[model samples]
Target: MKSTGDSKETFWKEYEKLPDAIKEALFSEENFKIVSDICEANGITSDESKSKLMKYVGKTLMGKLPIKDFFVTLELEMDMETNKAKAISREIDRKIFSGLRIALNKIYSTNIAENKIVSDNKRNKDGTEIPMPSKNEYKDPYKEPLI
Candidate 1:
């Protein structure tokens, strides 16, 4: 598996290969706003939200998680004042990004679990299960050390 830096580099490389129209659509303002809103809800400041949004957006695009889950619509709406056209979108659900955050968290937890030496199925080197001794089998260690 590639490290995050490698994956990030690969994502950007792939992003650069996309057509201008596709790139523009994928990184549209609606998506940015979604990212910013997510960051703000999680206590990230407005100043840092843009960069963080870009990072997560890149991850989402690169990871290829369900885009439909995050965004509901991508229609053009005319601005009432200038009568100019603008992209209007609605997020289907906020839980989508929250779920993505959870998915990413699982990645970290999985790594930790994988690196652990202990297994869930505990056993001794003699191929026998290491069972907890009963209280009656215990000795008073402070009085005398057990041999």
Candidate 2:
């Protein structure tokens, strides 16, 4: 929700200028705000932000998809470098999003753990027990499972 830039074009343009290897490695990373915020916070030059984003995106992909499937699909669709590049770029998008969601989940868990510790000692307005966060770990533990 942070104001990352004046417009979205700046975001995509920043993304495109990255080296082909980096662009390819991003695995379709799309936490636009996360990328923009990191860039802004770290004072990374545009080029550096691009490279860092690609690296993080790679970190994202290392968990969700098979490297072999990624390349095989790229080759299956491509008769040319540009086409292969575009195809691979699109392919990684899904993984980038998946990775972002995974990160959010982890953050949610940590917050839950924090909450649980605070809530466990309190009671409902009706004077009922606030059960200890079902999970004995982390903040925000009393929050119901979002699933």
Candidate 3:
């Protein structure tokens, strides 16, 4: 089995290869709700407390914000003391990050499967198989159905 660091590296590699549309989907409002539900079920944060965290997380995932900024924002937005904000950040990272990684992997795997299917169906004029596109080639976005 891969170590946590190895798996995380692999995850980010795959994440970087995803189309922008799919990357956007990973941090969509629907996914935020899913993460919120997961966190709420685990008693880490109340519904009222999640919005700020979720927004920061989304920004972080999109590469638009730093996590340190998230901690500060969490403290200010939720009116928590500094230590409380740090504790909540740790809890959120522990509880929510794993689930988000799993969701991203699922999305990435589905995209690979779909791309393979599309590539497999393609053939030359002489009916010979053509190679799959390079990593930079992005097809249409595939939307996963919400459960």
Model 2 residue-pair collision total: 16
* Candidate number achieving the greatest TM-score relative to the actual structure: 3
* lDDT value, residue 97 of candidate 3: 50
lDDT of each residue in 36-69, candidate 2, tens digit only: 5444544444865446445544533333233334
Give lDDT tens digits, candidate 3, residues 9-61: 97688668665654765567666766576557545477656766676676555
Candidate 1 residues lying further than 4 Å off, grouped into runs, are: 1-13, 16-25, 64-147
Order of candidate numbers by TM-score, starting with the best: 3, 1, 2
Tens-digit lDDT track of model 1 for 1-147: 569989779768877765454465466777677656654654446565447445534545443433442222111111112211011112313433443445444444554576668645568899887776677996767776559
Cα lDDT, all candidates: 0.47, 0.47, 0.63
Candidate 2 off by > 4 Å: 1-29, 64-147
Return the lDDT, model 1, position 68. 42
What would the TM-scores of all predictions be?
A: 0.30, 0.22, 0.38
Model 1 score (lDDT): 0.47
Model with the higher TM-score, candidate 1 or 2: 1
Residue 27 displacement (Å), model 1: 1.6
